[model samples]
Target: MTQNIGDALENSTSQASLAHSRKISEKIEQAIKEDATQFRVLTGDRPTGNLHIGHYFGSLQNRLRLQEAGVDTWVLVADYQVITDRDGVGPIKDRVYSLVTDYLALGIDPKRSTIFAHSQVPALNQLMLPFLSLVTDAELRRNPTVKSELEATDGRPMSGLMLTYPVHQAADILFCKANLVPVGKDQLPHLEQARVITDRFDARYGRPKGSDKRVFPRPQGLLSNAEMVLGLDGTKMSKSKGNTIELRMSADETAKLIKKAVTDSDRHISFDPVNRPEVANLLTLISLCTGQPQVEIADEIGDGGGGTLKKMLTEALNEHLAPFRARRAELEANPGYIVEVLHEGIARANAQADATLAEVRSAMNMVY
Candidate 1:
């Protein structure tokens, strides 16, 4: 089987990471075949804004699959992380609840998946202390996520939280011993750091060599199957850029947005992301909605022009999202249920985190 396994590990372009990605990709397949119940997955979203199609295609869809496969899945609403790079955390409480609503509406069954708020889980955050000690300041600066976030902030001095954002994420994963983290190519580095932290702690503090007491599982990045989901303007889909379609937008709102999506003057629709990115993005969105091959969709819309392509997308996408909208409306009507779900998740997360922390302390001989 020829594998461009290189792409799955696009976490790093180096030969080593490519080789490692191939091995993990195969392990992921085997893990699904084995007793999946033995594996736990930790995935999350920072409640910065409403989730967009990029999120759906990028990670959430895979999350739903993992949930259905009977794997233990936990979705963290990283409420505190929202303040990492930003100055003022905007309507965070609302966004956090809205995130839970989106998850429920999108079929993330709380009964199966533990959906928790980071701020509500104290024990989990407690793991950050020992984790912080395990990582060096030089290592923190070397993190690509830290560098990228720093670059995003125009020369402003970064906060201590921002400097150690990656370790916080490592804490998120290790606190629960989550072995699989669904991530995009851009997030591979963050997952790598979590693995590094788990290994470091295990080495320095874990039980003896012959009878090693592994307190944390080295998490692996389960690469998303979707390509880089672009915005209507053919740029990275971003809420800040206003180029995204939020998951909660009504059908009419979605149609209005798609109507304004960028496209070329060519009447013939085709999938050529290289030279005709805008047209290709529209086609890709349509394919994602209808689950048809992009080339086939483009051929089906040949010579129909951008208007016809957008029309098809608006229709397909609205139909696809209609059920989610209905579900969300019902969930919105009962805000209590949303809070109940979050509270339950926090309880479960606290239990797991406390257990891990207790064991970690014992391993490090810090129980005293």
Candidate 2:
């Protein structure tokens, strides 16, 4: 059971907090608009499993927006991070290829964005050593997201890698000095830790005596406006649960999944998320897909029972995902092309990461 990054933030959310996040998002957008080249976005998932609808709506869409806006995008497969909680690494390269296809299917242009596997960048991982020294064990233990994930591990002994996840995440963002990260509220703490590391490291060394610039810019969290998309069972969509509508699923497979969705017996459906979450979850999906409000969709499907609701959702979802599916099919067939994409991305990442590492070494007076 993979725990979400922000299980602790559930209790901390409020209108005021959301408003603050939105304000920050607006500031970043304006900054990017003024000078897109001055900003870079670091976003991608660990090669855990097939990315589901939850990923698409939650994070993928925002990354696309940033790329389309001409911001430099660095997408990391985070291959090493997969070993954090598990004894087995599983088929990481395969997962990375799947994730890349999902990205391509969903509009991640390799030409416009650099996508690379974590293990391919040695200089990037090397950052972990100095970064580890910058933070205390107490500080690492204090991260709320880390705490939640530890609990999610179901009492398995926490590995050192797991404990240092936030630091590793910091390496991902700072290795290339990405100034903006697409994150939800739960990940704010993770981003904050990266900022902390950047601040401390910059103050300690590496800015070049009078270059008038810090070694690394403290990256900001680009808070998302996406909603929490529930799975068929009215719970958070997760790959482990087999409740997700994965981007790679066939149209028929998607329809079958929706058909099995748990909806209430109430023939008269309304968008009452707090009361009838299962049906409301279906409404939410339809709304996200069709760009129509949940209430309106519920009204249209009123008294039609769960069957009609599922049917509507099936059509809307499939129609919305057809292009992505078509592109994914072609990409899946062209395995060689995917390798080329990964190779190009890895080469680009190597140059960027090597430069960053050189600066870090020089700053710490360890440039032997």
Candidate 3:
């Protein structure tokens, strides 16, 4: 009788676990459907150089997904935020246009998604004034992304703009009244700071105690499932590190880079990121491109060694990126098209930003 009770208890626990998992899965499906049909998504990049596959897997692909879902998408070319650490802006105009061209080549429709230069949006900058006042210095100093960036600059003196760029980000989001900010885990802290500022601003100058409407909706982070794409050297893919596969690289260049990528000497192929990060990173990259499981990729390669893996990766990447390169080449031919896209995006962005800024000023009684 005691044995029967034990078996019954175990069965009950298993059933409960399965039920819970089903509930969670249902919620996730619902969220994905909702995101596809309705949401305001804000996501962008700082154009320091040509974007790598890391940028694509990390954010750009997700942006395209949402845009296709009919979600209101806004992509910012954060030009103003680029000078926080660097001294002189090197060919910033070319970089900005390159970034826009890449966006167009990747299927980010200028009509469906508003893509604009951050520096050109005056209302976004104006919104920063009050937002700056809402956060404390200590809070700025504590931002993890800021700390990592400062460290990357190797103990350089912290610039004021660098410290308060999180506030600038808040303005970027709120100026467009963004309710969903797609981000990686590393960026959660920045979005959290944005939320804190939004709450404080709403309390200070939002609708009266009895009113229902509020000025700014506290934005939430839509955390990405994608992992941090490692560079050829098994570190972060960085332009400075010279270990990135740029999105626009030709097939030969990509093949050369993959050939030179660091990998282990072990004859066996396996996905062990901790022990064989180089090999595992390659497999991860392949999986991302091919939509195949890493285990399957490893099994297929099966003791063919790193050389076999690199060859496979090279072919996969070149094949995958061919369309993107062709599209970008076409866009490059008509440089005026890139300029026109930016101008149209800027006009649309300014109109939306101005409307939001007017509401903000009125709420703060700055409408004299």
TM-scores vs. true structure, each candidate:
0.94, 0.94, 0.89
Model 2 spans > 4 angstroms off: 1-19, 152-155
Tell me the deviation in Å of residue 171 in model 1. 0.3
User: Candidate 3 — which residues are off by over 4 angstroms?
Assistant: 1-29, 35-37, 149-155, 208-212
Estimate the lDDT of model 1.
0.85
Which pairs of residues collide in model 3? none
| Candidate 1 segments exceeding 4 Å error | 1-16, 208-211
Q: For candidate 2, lDDT tens digit of each residue in 11-41?
A: 2355666677779889988988898898899
The predicted structure with the larger TM-score, 1 or 3, is 1
Question: lDDT tens digits, residues 93-206, model 1?
Answer: 899999999999999998999999878888889888988887777667767777777788787988999998988998888888898888766677777777777777776776
Clashing pairs in 2: none
The candidate 1 region of ten consecutive residues with least summed lDDT is: 1-10
**What C-alpha lDDT does candidate 2 achieve relative to the native structure?**
0.87
Report how far residue 245 has shifted in candidate 3, in Å.
0.3
